[model samples]
Target: MIFIRKSNDRGRSQTKWLSSFHTFSFAGYYDPKFIEFGHLRVINEDTVQPGFGFEKHPHSNMEIISYVVEGSLEHRDSIGNGSVIKPGELQIMTAGTGIEHSEFNHSQMDLLHFLQIWIVPEKTNLTPSYQQITINKVLNQFVLIGSQNKQDGTVIIHQDVNLYVAFLTRNISIDYSLKANRKGWLQLVKGKIKLNNQTLLVGDGAAIQNEKINLQCIEDSELLFFDLSSN
Candidate 1:
């Protein structure tokens, strides 16, 4: 089954410096029907104005992932990990126990665009940690960016999930099969694409279960695919 979460239907939070669209319940956005998809908790598409960003905040027992779409993201956390994430890079912060973090736009002249994802951990109270990796997306091919076991040098997350990304050009197509009892979530980062005959535009998402995903690019696009446990 394929259930779509349309771009226009997502909840929005806008401030003088920030604009965020939530795919699930988050902060001040709540939709009972879209609370979550399996263990995938939050998917926030955010844009920050020049010289502005998020200040220190705390989180616990959640696997937080960051993917920058444009500009540079400066991240600093209580765990002594600090870095600048540019386009084509991925960062993960395991907020086990608890942690305080801040994210800002490194470029004072360009708007910062990114996605913030949260996944519930399989177990709680583990030590907090952070990791960042450079990922080069290949056309029409799945690139493993995060997984339970750090597959293909991807960052490790404390959950039964695998995150993949791909960049596609017009007319390209790809296929992925889900194992029995597994679940899938697809997020369209940029441009348009057709997922199993259903079209998705920027900021759109789809939930899948017990199905094979067929994707065809309607234009140049970037996307994220998640393979998750049924639980």
Candidate 2:
């Protein structure tokens, strides 16, 4: 089965400093029908003003990830990790036990655009940790960014999930197969693409179960793919 979540149909939270679109229920934007897909709980496409950002917030038992689409993101956490993440970079924080963090736009003039994702941990109360990596080594192919096993330089997360990223040129095609009893989520970061014959524009997301997927870029595009457990 496949379900397409249109970009325009997502929930929105807008303010003077931040403009965010939520693929699933988030904060004040709750939709009972779109709570989650498998273990993938949240996907927020956010654009922040040059000098404003989210204040310190607390989280627990959730795997948090940040993917910078444009500009730079400055992150500081209670765990003593502080850094500026730019395009083609990904950051993950395991909020086990409990942790507090804040995210801001590092640039004084450029608006920061990024995605923040949250996945429920397999088990609770694990140790908190952080990982970040540059994902520009390969192009037009799925590069593993995070997984349960930490394979191929991917960040280790406390869940049975595999996260892959791809940067494609126009007319390029790619194939992906979902294992038996597993699920998948495809998120379009920018540009246009055709997934399994269905078109997806920027900010669109697709949920798939038990299927072989084929993708062809209609334009230069960037996307993130998640292989998840059925449960």
Candidate 3:
């Protein structure tokens, strides 16, 4: 089975400096029917104006990953971790019991565009931690970014989810074999592509439950694929 979620169909939240689109129910945007998919809870695409950002916030029992597309986002947490994430970088945070963190634009005049992902943990109350990696070395193909066992040198998370990303050239095609009892979500972050027979543009999302996924790049593209265990 496959379901398509158009970019405009997503829930939207906009403030003076922040414009966010929620792939699942988040913040003030609520839709009971779209609460979550499998263990993939949230995928928020956010744009922040220069000199603006989110203040300290509390989270628990959730594994969060931050991917910067443009500009830079600065992160600070109660765990005494502070860093600036730039384009082609990722930040992972495990808010096990509880943790406080803040994300803000690291620049004074550049718009910050990024994706914030949330996945439910395999077990609760484990431990709070942080990890980061630079993906400039892995471009033009699907590469593991987050996983449970440090698989493929990905940032370890507290869930049975494996996150992969690709930077594909025009007219390229790639195949992914999806294991039985598992499902996947493909998100087109930039440019255009064809997932199986479905054409997806920027901000479009596709959920696939088939045994295999075939991606054909219509143009230069950036994509994120999540392989999640069926619960």
Candidate 4:
């Protein structure tokens, strides 16, 4: 089965320096019916002004993943990790017991656009951790950004989930064979595409609980996919 989440139906909030959309229940936008999907908890599309960003905040028992779509994001955490994530970079933070971190735009003239994802960890109180990977080497194929084992340069998380990113030009297509008993979610970060015969535009998403999925690029597109188990 495949369920589509239209881009326009998501919760939206706009501030003078920030614009965001929530795919699941987050912050002040609460919807019981859309609280979560399996272990996938939060999917937030955020754009920050050149000089603005999220202040230092605390998190616990959740795996946070950040994907930069445009511009750059400056990150600093209590774990002694500090870096600037430019376009095509992935950052993952595991707030096992607890952790404090802050994200900033860092750029004086360019706005920062990125996605923040939260997934429920399989076990709590493990340990707080941070890692970032650059994807400049894998621009054409789907690159593993986050996984349980930290393989393929991906940051290790506490759950049995895999996150992948792909940059596809027009007419490019790929088929992903879903593992037995596993589910998938595809989010179109930019441009247009077709997933299992369903057309998806930017900010659109599809939850596929089926056996397989076929993704075809209708235009230049950047996409994110999550393969998760139904725990």
Candidate 5:
């Protein structure tokens, strides 16, 4: 089964300094049927104005991932983790017991664009931690971004999930085999692609299950794919 979610169909919110689009029910957006998929809970695309960002906020029992798209984000957390996440960089934060964090645009003039993702951890009340890594080492193909095992040269997550990123160009095709009883989700960051005959454009997403993923690159594209245990 494959379910499509269009760009404009997402929950939208705009503030003086922030504009956000939510793929799943978040904050003030609630849809009984769209609360979550598998263990993947939230996918929020955010754009922050210069000199502006999120203030210290608390979260617990969730695995958070942040990927910068265009500009840089300055981060500081209760765990003493602080850094600037630039384009091609990713940040991982595990709010096991509880944690407070803040994020701001690292630039004084450039708008900061990024994606924030929240995944439900397999276990609760674990210790909190943080990590940030550059993704330049995983370009132009499907590269593991996060996994339960730590040997994949990627960030570790407390869940049965395999997250991947790929840069696809026209005339290229990538094939992915789905494990039994697992499901998938594809988030297209830019350009166009055709997944098993289903066409998707920039900012589009699809929920997939019980089938192979045949990715036909219709144009130069950047995307994220999640292979997750069935919900």
Candidate 6:
């Protein structure tokens, strides 16, 4: 089964320096029916103005992952990790016990656009950790962006989920076979695509519990897919 979450249906908030859309219940936008899907908790599409950002905040028992779509985000955390993440880079911070961090736009002129995702960790009170991976090598295939193990060529999270990003040219097609006991969430970041005969535009998403999926790029498209364990 596949359920569609239209882009316009997401909760939206706009500030002078920040514009954000929430896919699930987050902050002041509470919707009981849309609280969360499986272990996937939060998906926020954010655009930040120059010289603006999120101050140091605390989080616990949650795996936070950030994917930069445009511009750059400077990240600093209590775990002694600091870096500037640009497009095609993924950062994962496991706020196991407790951690404080800040994210700011690194560009002085260009606005920073990105996606922030949070997933419930499989185990709590493990340890606070951080990981960043450059995805320049996987521009051709569906690159693994997030995983639960450091052995993979991606950032490790304390969750039983896998995040993938694909950049496909116009008229290209990609087929994905879902695991027997796993589910999938597909989000179109830019351009247009057809997933199993269903057309999805930019910002649109679909939750798939089916056996397989066929994604056809109607236009040059950039998309993100999350494969989550059912257990």
Compute each candidate's TM-score over C-alphas: 0.98, 0.98, 0.97, 0.96, 0.97, 0.96
Cα lDDT of model 5 by residue, 1-231, tens digit: 888889889999999999999999999988788899989999999999999999999999999999888999999999898899997778999999999999999899999999999999999998999987777554457888789998546899899999888988787998998889899999999899998999998889999987888999989899999999985
Candidate with more favorable, higher lDDT: 4 or 5 = 5
For candidate 3, what is the TM-score? 0.97
Candidate 1 vs 5: which has more lDDT: 1
Off by over 4 Å in 2: none
Q: Scored by CA lDDT, what does every candidate get?
A: 0.93, 0.93, 0.91, 0.89, 0.91, 0.89
What does the lDDT read for residue 173 in candidate 2? Answer: 97
Model 2, residue 226: distance off in Å is 0.5
Please provide, for model 1 over 46-104, each residue's C-alpha lDDT reduced to its tens digit, 9 standing for 90 to 100: 99999899899999999999999999999999989899999999999999999999999
Model 2: per-residue Cα lDDT at residue 18 = 96
Worst 10 residues of 2 by lDDT: 149-158
lDDT of 6 by residue, 1-231 (tens): 988899999999999999999999999898887898889999999999997999999999999989899999999999899999999788888899999999999988999999999999998896998888888544436887678776666787778888888998888888888888899988899999888889999899899996588888899889889999977
Q: Give candidate 1's error at residue 189 in angstroms.
A: 0.3
Question: Tens digits of per-residue lDDT for model 3 on 1-231?
Answer: 878899999999999999999999998999997898889999999999999999999999999999998999999999999999998888999999999999999999999999999999999997899999887445567798888898545799888888998999899889999898899999889999888878999999988896578888999999889999987
Model 2 scores what on Cα lDDT? 0.93
Per-residue lDDT of candidate 4, residues 118-169 (tens digit)? 9999998978988888765465477787888857677787899988888888
Q: What is the lDDT of candidate 6?
A: 0.89
